[model samples]
Target: MVEITLKGITKRFGNFLALDNINLKINDREFMALLGPSGSGKSTLLYTIAGIYRPTRGRIYFDDRDVTDIPPKDRNVGLVFQNWALYPHMTVFENIAFPLELRKVPRDEIERKVREVAKMLHIENLLHRYPWQLSGGQQQRVAIARALVKEPDVLLLDEPLSNLDTLLRLEVRAELKRLQKELGITAVYVTHDQAEALAMADRIAVIKEGKILQVGTPNEVYYKPKYKFVGWFLGNPPMNFVEAEVEGDYLRVYSSRIPVPSHYREIIEKLGIKEVILGFRPHDAQIVKGVGDGLLGEVYSFEPLGREQIVTISLDGVFIKVFAPEEESFTFGEKVTVEIREDRIILFDKEKEVALEYLYKD
Candidate 1:
């Protein structure tokens, strides 16, 4: 396993910057994911690390050695793409053994390694099948097995599950995670799917416009987002942001003004922020009664999602969603009091889009 490091990485195409000055360290044997939107430079960074693209400026290091200029073949990295990229005429066994064969492994050793990896990936029974004869998931496994057959120092996957259908994607995702853990391979996985990153990564680097916004565990990024963008990017229903003003010890959201919880008073006071954006997850906003210290909004619509419902409410013309159990139902145009648990409230500077720390008073 090798720790991959990128320092002062920058990439440009003519006048457009594809990747900004980016610095990241991925630990050895760690499953690190680069997640962002389509134009967010996640794939660009992956290709740079894989030696497929030379950076406009920056140095890449594997462990202690600089490999910024190394060729892809000499990097000892296995790259799996979105497409299965299997040879149509070769059987699964021959495809998996192709890499070892290229490396000139003896015939007996190739057979042993091919069977071992095939069994490990649970594709041994399908080894005799041609690429056209196998299902999408099976073909994906064959691609992965081919990548692993060489015992690469690191593995790079660029949206490897995107080609599969929803159910097959889920199945392959589980299998990929299992295989990565079992082999203890240091892997860099690039995906735009937030759920996939949340489920598979030991740590995720959220990127936008070729720069990293934040890098943290799923919980940290979700619950304690350092930036509003990070918070808005990771959740299923996404986070709701309400424009608000900070006054003395309270925040005024729409027509409803509530005192900032006592615990956060010190931080609010220290920051001296007069204007801020209030952020809260859908799950954190609840419906309460009797004009509690919460926003007053009318339900606009509700989407039933099996176990829970996403309730959309309008506060001062701004729509906000709340996740409630299926048992909790609200009707359109119904007046409802929305209670935002103070502890779950995330504050951001509207202009900077950066999270503001809450100072707790004892």
Candidate 2:
């Protein structure tokens, strides 16, 4: 196990800044994921850590040793690529043993390590099969086994399951999590999938425009996002945003003003915010009968999901999605009020578009 530290890490591709002043610490034996949309520098950061792409500036440390200048093969880290990069002509055994062979390990030692990971991944029976003959999931396991055979201090996976089918991806996700916990090997995963990052990592680092936006446990990032982008980027349906005005501690959403929660009262007074953005997740909102304590809207669309319905309501001009229980039924263009959970409300500065939760007097 190794603790990985990156400080002032910056990467440039000629004129393009791939990573900008990135600073992060991945603890020993911790599963950390770098998550973001495409071209967001997540892969670049992962490659830099894997020693595949050297950063233009900053230092990288493994434990207490500086390894920024180390070559990819000399970094003592196992890397699995998105494409799996399996040798089509080589048997599973040969593919898994290639890394060991490159390091000039004895044949006997290579055989033992190769068989061990194969058995662990339940691919032992396919050791003699070539890459072309193996299933996608089986091939992915082979790729992972190849990386793990060397038993390096760090394991890096770049969208390792992106190529698999949905069911296969779910199966592999569990396998990957189980293997990481069973071996307690430090891992860094890179992907654009929010569910993948949330499900697999001990902590998730959300990156955007080559900068780290936030890093926290799944619950932290999900429940208490520090920025508007973090809140909007995480949820399955993502968070809904409304342009609101702070009119004497109350938020003016559309024509009606909603009362602000008491916990945020002191901070709201302190910040003296004239304009603020109200953010809430689809699950946090509920469709109520009357408009007594909620915002009014007409059911624009109702999507059924066996257990419940995802109801999209047209609020004046803005549309918001609400998760409704299966027992509830709504007709098209039906009017209803949405009760936004006060405690779960996320307030962001209208100008800066950053959460104000940290400014409150707790």
Candidate 3:
């Protein structure tokens, strides 16, 4: 395994800049995900790392070795693409052995390695099947096996499970995570799916339009987002942003004013932020009954989401969503109280649209 690093990596296409001064590190044996939305420069960054596209500026390194000018074939990296990239005419055995064959491995050794990886991937039974003969999930395994058969120092995957059905995607995701851990390969996975990154990666570098916003563990990014965009991007149903005016230790959110949490009090006072944006996740707030530290609102709509339900409360003109059990039911215009987890409330600077740091923590 190798520690891959990109220093001030910038990729530009004519007048359009794909990656703007990106600096990231994937530690040895680490599973890191480049996460972002479509056209957010995530796939561009991955391809850059794979030596497929030369960066317009900056350098690439593999464990102190400068490989910025090296070709993709000499990078000692394996890449799996979204479409599987399987050859319809080639059997699974031949496909997996292609990389080894490129290096002139003997037929006996190739057969051994091919069968070994196929069994490891639980596709030994399908070794003779062509790409057209296998299901989506099986084809995905074959693609991954081809990447691993060479024992490449680093593995790069570009939305490898995006084409699979929901259940198959889940199955393949688990297998990939297990294989990476067992092999201890440094892996960089690029995807727009938050759940995939959160589930598989040890660390995630959240990207948006060519710039990285934050890099941290899944819990760190979710619970303590460094920017409002990160907070808004990482959550399901996203976060509810309420415009508020800070006064002393209280914020006048729309028509409801609530005292700021103790943890954020010092920052609020220090910044003397007159106008701020308050953000909290839907699951972090619960419905209460005229309870202390709660906001009163009327239910506007309720969405049933299989395992869980969401209650959209009309907080005056602004709507706030709260998580409820699937069995929980509510009526339109019904009065409801929402108690937010005080410590979990996030304060952001409205002008800069970024999170404000607390001067002191409790």
Candidate 4:
């Protein structure tokens, strides 16, 4: 097992800067995920750790050893690409054994290691099958087995499950998490899929535009995001935002005015923030049937999803979604109210677009 660290890491492709002054410490035997959208420099960060792309500036360390100048072959890291790069010409066994063969391991040891990893990945039965003859799931298992056969200290996966079907992806996702824990190996996964990172990683580093926005556990990032972008980027239906202006002790939202909660008043007064953006998750809102101390809106649309439904409400010209039980029914343009959970509401500076620390009272 190894604890990987990247300090002041910066990667530039000529004039285009890919990674900006990145500093992170990946704990030993920890599962860390690099999550971002496409062209967000997540893949570049992974390759840099694998010694495939040398950083323009900064140093990489595995535990206490600085490996800034080390070659990929000497890094002792296992890398699984998005497109499971398996050789179609070779059988699964041969593909898994290729790494050991490169080191000229005795033929007997190579066979033993290949079989061992194949069994671990539950691909032992398909060892004799070529890549062309196997299913996508089987091929991905083979790719993982090939990486694991070398007993690497750190495992790096670049969206390895992106190509698989939903069911197969879930299966592989669970298996990978289980195997990482069972083997006690340090792992770094790169993916833009928020669900995958939330379900699997011990900690997630949310990256955007070659810079890490936030690094925290799943619950921390989901519930108490440091940046407004982090909150907006993580949720399923995404968080809803509404512009508000401080009007005396009340916050004016559209034509309605609601009293400022005691928890947020101090901070708003301290910062003297007049204009702010109020964010609340769909699940954190209560859809009331009548007029009350809440944002007034009308039901615009309904999307039923088995046990629950997403109710879209139009507050004047602004629209927001609310999660309601399936039993709750509403007609088009029906008058309704949305009561945002005051404790769960995230207040952000309208200009800076960053979260305000207003829950300190609790």
Residues 1-362, model 4: lDDT tens digits: 99999999999999999999999999999999999999999999999999999999999999999999999999999999999989889999999999999999999999899989999999989989889999999999999999999999999999999999999999999999999999999999999999999999999999999999889998888888877888888989888989999998999999788888677888988778788888889999999997887999999999999999999999997999999999998899998989988888878888778776732332
Local accuracy of candidate 1 as per-residue lDDT tens digits, 58-105: 999999999998999899999899897999989999999999988899
- Model 3: per-residue lDDT, tens digit, 1-362? 99998999999999999999998889999999999999999889999999999999999999999999999999989999999999888999999999999999999999999999999999999998899999999999999999999999999999999999999999889989999999999999999999999999999999998999999999998888888888888878898888888877688877677898898787777766788888999999898644345677888999898999999998886798889888777888887788888889988888777888832231
lDDT (CA) per prediction:
0.89, 0.91, 0.90, 0.92
lDDT of 3 at 241: 84
Candidate 4: list runs displaced more than 4 Å: 358-362
Error (Å) of candidate 3 at residue 108 is 1.2
Writing each residue's lDDT as its tens digit, candidate 2 over 209-299 gives 9999999998889988988999888987889998888888678888667898676787788877778888999999889865656777888
Model 4's lDDT to the true fold? 0.92
Task: Look at candidate 3 and tell me the lDDT of residue 185.
Answer: 98
Task: Give candidate 2's error at residue 267 in angstroms.
Answer: 1.4
Error of 2 at 262 (Å): 2.2
Q: Candidates sorted by lDDT, descending order?
A: 4, 2, 3, 1
> Measured by C-alpha RMSD in angstroms, how accurate is candidate 1?
2.4
lDDT of 2 at 90: 92
Show how many residue pairs clash in every candidate, following the order shown: 1, 0, 0, 0
Q: Between 3 and 4, whose TM-score is larger?
A: 4
